[model samples]
Target: TPPDPGDRIPTGFADLDTLTSGGLRPGRMVVVGARPGVGKTLVGTGLARAAAIKGGLPTLFKTLEMGDEE
Candidate 1:
């Protein structure tokens, strides 16, 4: 079953959570867009790590640009 839409999943960053009104909402899609070398991957991995480790939420990560070793 899907999580409640009103539920927020923290990203392990206080400032980010504040900006996003306590973190990301469940059952919503988020897109991170930026120029190259602007920490897009860093932010994405951080969020995934936070969700999986801190929030204890099931997460899925898929990347077309990176290989298994990366």
Candidate 2:
């Protein structure tokens, strides 16, 4: 089925959604990259939270550098 018109998956921030012309497109892969202590984990966790909690979308978060307990 086709996606609903004007449907957008919010990034949990209105400002960022506006900047991206309505958040992320459906079925698209998004990669967030940055130097250490630069909020890469912050952003990834935030997005995952938004997708899972706010948008009710299934999300998977994985990390290679950090351990399960951090």
Error of 1 at 18 (Å): 0.7
Q: Model 2: per-residue lDDT, tens digit, 32-65? A: 8877788888888888889888888999877665
TM-score, prediction 2:
0.81
Which pairs of residues have clashing backbones in candidate 1? none
lDDT of 1 by residue, 1-70 (tens): 8887777889878899999888898877767778877877888888888889988888876665677998
Q: How well does candidate 1 match the true structure in TM-score terms?
A: 0.78
TM-score of each: 0.78, 0.81
lDDT score of residue 26 within candidate 2: 72
Clashes of each: 0, 0
